[model samples]
Target chain A: MRLRADLVPQDNLSYQDVVLVVDVIRATTTATAFLEAGASSLYLTAGLESARAFRDDDVVLAGEEGGLKPAGFDYGNSPREAKEAPVGGKIVVLSTTNGTRTAHLAARSAKHVLLASLYNAHAAARLAHQLATEEVAILCAGKEGRIGLDDVYTAGVLAEFLQIMGSYELEDGALTALTTRRAYPDPLEPLHLSAAAQALRQVGLEADVPFCAQIAASPAVGVLEGRVGEALIFKRA
Target chain B: MRLRADLVPQDNLSYQDVVLVVDVIRATTTATAFLEAGASSLYLTAGLESARAFRDDDVVLAGEEGGLKPAGFDYGNSPREAKEAPVGGKIVVLSTTNGTRTAHLAARSAKHVLLASLYNAHAAARLAHQLATEEVAILCAGKEGRIGLDDVYTAGVLAEFLQIMGSYELEDGALTALTTRRAYPDPLEPLHLSAAAQALRQVGLEADVPFCAQIAASPAVGVLEGRVGEALIFKRA
Candidate 1:
């Protein structure tokens, strides 16, 4: 087995059999929390218009752009919001700045796509290992064109879990991630110092910092099953 | 002051005032060794043909393709070769796989470009600090568009030095590099475990590993002053 780590979701990411998309500062964290909180499923859309169009009585519109909730969105892109929202047995239509776009892009080429964060790193890694694929790609949903520390740190956490499973050959990026995880065993330091975390704190969302920093808080893994028309449906893995 | 770290040289890197291009596992390391070995100056070129075309009585063609010296090249891309070569008062024309290509790309936009490696990291950082440019970019010459552990680790070493010198806002990549440096104070561990190091050992070139791992072995910083016709001229910074 071979494990590859991509610091950012570059254009050509269609080669891997399984791809774990990570946005630890809260997109994937929120998604996993929603699943763990009893949301039936989620429809991940990249554009705000698609998310709004897919919303209904049974669907909750959750997401943020520029760290602020949209005018009519039901919830902002916060794990705290997902934890408190009425998501039981409901389908969540989600859109955000980076995470959902990365998921949509990964869905184009990846046979199986899973959302990973510190909250669901172990579950995501176990699911990837269970798939028994030759290659697993961990794609970080970096902020804009640059890498975000929190996302890469979360990728390191996932890489560490995958490495512990045995019988895997790690590529350079994987080794880098593993080394990173070893260097900082405590994930909270890097996350608190991350640009995304600082932005959240500036926006008076300091509560989200410790909330998103929880590792393995949820055993739920958000797996992209397939597309339902224009929406990418994520089922619990 | 702002410090930015790019794990790999992405396309169109036309943003910084001063760019420090690093290839820890041989190119920049070898170049630093050559300059420190009493060579008057070195010429860096990305293409083999360009390296060959610039050769003259006083110039020696040195480089490697796929870890082996080419048929017509004067020397292979090895610091050991450079350290022993009769390059005294001679201009060494150089070309390698990743390092030179990254330097060429960085030259397009950067006002000043310098070659950095573990051998010359401290010197490079001091030079960057001395330049006092508003923005400084550390571009890692990654292996085939992927992050190379050796390069990133060396970048971290440079970042650590720059951070200690003055107050500067670090971008995410810079913070990641700084964090990496703090994680591994001893540079040899990551260099030995790097993919490039394994490849060198496979080809019976394991001797280069320890030679390249010596931090601050050379105080010379390879600064790209200008081009003579087609060859890039490097002076001691």
Candidate 2:
């Protein structure tokens, strides 16, 4: 399999058979947690208003606006909270600063889109490699179209898992990510140094960093099913 | 002192007191070499046509179109050639694929602009640190607006040198670069693995890689003076 990792997604990213979108400092981790917690489906909205529009008795609203829980939301973008939420068989409507927007972008060209995080990195890599027809791309949900160190390091973890499953040529971004991932033996070292983690800490969400850094904590893989209106829906695979 | 490394120059980079533009594959190296070889000034153009416009008998035209010397140019983007050229006291008009364009962008906001490469990495970093009043940004001249591993590694080298000069807070990109730089003991290892080096090898310019990888080979620091028409002029500082 041919493999590439875009440290940050851009308008010029080419099509791939399998695309893994990673947002380790919350979005992807939270999404994976929701899936692992037995949520039947997760709808990723681009903004708060769209996510709030899905408010219903059967749906749980979960997301963050500025690293804080939005007003009246069921939960903030906290994986720990997501893991503990009793959402089995219920649909989750989510929106965040970066990850959801990146999912929408990844859905534009890839044959398959899978949400990836340190929480489910191994499982996501295995599923993606098994499903890839030829090319596989790991796209980091960068902060506001910039390379987020947290996401890049998470991409490195997924890239490492993918390489272990098979022989694949690595791109520049992939090589950089691998180098970074290898440098920090502890996941929290790099993750805590990231702007994302610092932002979370500034908002009294410091616990989320360690929770998000738990590598392979979940075997669940959140695979993009299809788009329903403005939200891209994901289901456990 | 505040230090930041932009692995790839983007639209969102904030203002900095000093900006060091690095294009390790060839551009900045060649420019530095020309100044070291006693060239009076180097004019950086964004394209081939503008470089050709400076076709005066006294001016030496140098640049690469696609990893190869362009037709009618005095030399390709080769630091080795620049070192040996009889460009003493003569003006050299240069245009390159990525480096010159990045310099133009850097000139837009920086109080001081310096060309950096492994050839003059130490001097460039020192000069930048000395010239900076508040923030210093190392801008990597990435390949076609994408992160080039060679440039990123070069940025790391510069960042390392800057850190040695004093204590400076690092941004995420700067931290990533420092990690990458620390991982490679030999500069040629990462440089050879880069897509930029692969392209150069494909075009039979493999010799340029080692030449560009020579750390601190030259003490010459190319400082941007001002612009002349479509070209940004650099002089030895």
Candidate 3:
């Protein structure tokens, strides 16, 4: 088996059997938490308009723009909010600045797409190992078009888990992620030191810092099942 | 002062006072070793044809394509060959797969561009600290527009040196580099584990592997002083 890790999703990605999209601090983290807390499924929309269009009695609209809850949204992109929401048997439609875009991008190219973060890294790795067809791509949702430390650090963590799970040849990007994981063994260090973390702290959302830093807090593995209209539906695997 | 580290040069880079382009595996390392071993100067060419065009009695042409020396080139992209060449008082023109392209790209956007590698990382850091106008951008000449572990590890080493030399706020990329350096304190580990190193070993150029791994082996810092038509002229600083 071969594992390829990309710091960000690029336009030229070839076909992969499995693609794991990571957005720590805290998009995928929140989504995974919602699933673990009994949300039936998540509709990952690429924009605020698409997410809002999915509003219904059985759907909870959650997302953030510029780190603030969009006007009239049910919740911001916070794992704490996802964990506390009354999401039992509900479909949570979500959109965010970076994570949703990455999910949709991966959905267009890979046969199977899984959401990964510190909350579900190990679970995602295990699922990937079980389903991969000789190749797996870990795509980090970098801040805008640039590499974000938080996502890269989480990718490193996930890469390490996959390395330990099987005998596989890793590409350069995977080696980079492994090296990053070795550098920051404590997940909290990357959380506290990341630019996204600092931005959150500045906005007085300091509580989300430690919450997003919890590694494997949720056993949920979010796999993209199909698309419902303009949203990609993710079911827990 | 502010330090921004990029895993690879992006098309939308902002203006910087000083840009340090690094390709640690071979190109910049080889150039630094050449200058340290009494070469008067280097002419960094972006293409094989351009490098050949500059060939004269006082100039030697060198480069590599697909990890092999091009036919009729005076030398390959190997520090061992560069170190042994009698380049005293002569100009050595070089073209490589990645490094020269990065040098030219940085030259177009920044006031000053310098070549860096593990061999002259400390020297490049010191020079950047001395000459930067409140901002320094470290651009890693990654392998074909993707992140290369050897270059990023060398960038991490240089970022650590810059942090120790002055008071500066590091961007996320720089912080990542510093963290990587902290993880692998011994430079040889990254060199041996890098994809470039493995390729060199496969090609039977194993001697260049350890030679390129030597930190601070050369005090030469390649500063782009001028351009002769399409070639960038470098002088040791």
Fnat for each predicted structure, in order? 0.59, 0.57, 0.59
Residue A154 accuracy (lDDT) in model 3: 88
Worst window of 10 by summed lDDT in candidate 1 chain B: B7-16
- lDDT score of residue B45 within candidate 3: 89
A107-178: candidate 2 lDDT, tens digit per residue: 998999999999998999999999998988988887776678898889889989999999999878889999
Per-residue lDDT over A53-90 for candidate 1, one digit per residue giving the tens place of the 0 to 100 score: 98688989988888878879998888988987889999
Residue pairs whose backbone atoms clash in candidate 2: none
Question: Candidate 1: DockQ?
Answer: 0.58
Off by over 4 Å in 2: none
Per-candidate TM-scores read 0.93, 0.97, 0.93
Interface RMSD, candidates in the order listed: 1.5, 1.2, 1.5
Docking class of 1: medium
> What level of docking quality does candidate 3 show?
medium
Report lDDT per candidate. 0.85, 0.90, 0.85
DockQ winner: 2
Kindly list the per-residue Cα lDDT of model 2 for residues B186-234, writing each as its tens digit. 9999999999999998899999999999999899999999888989999
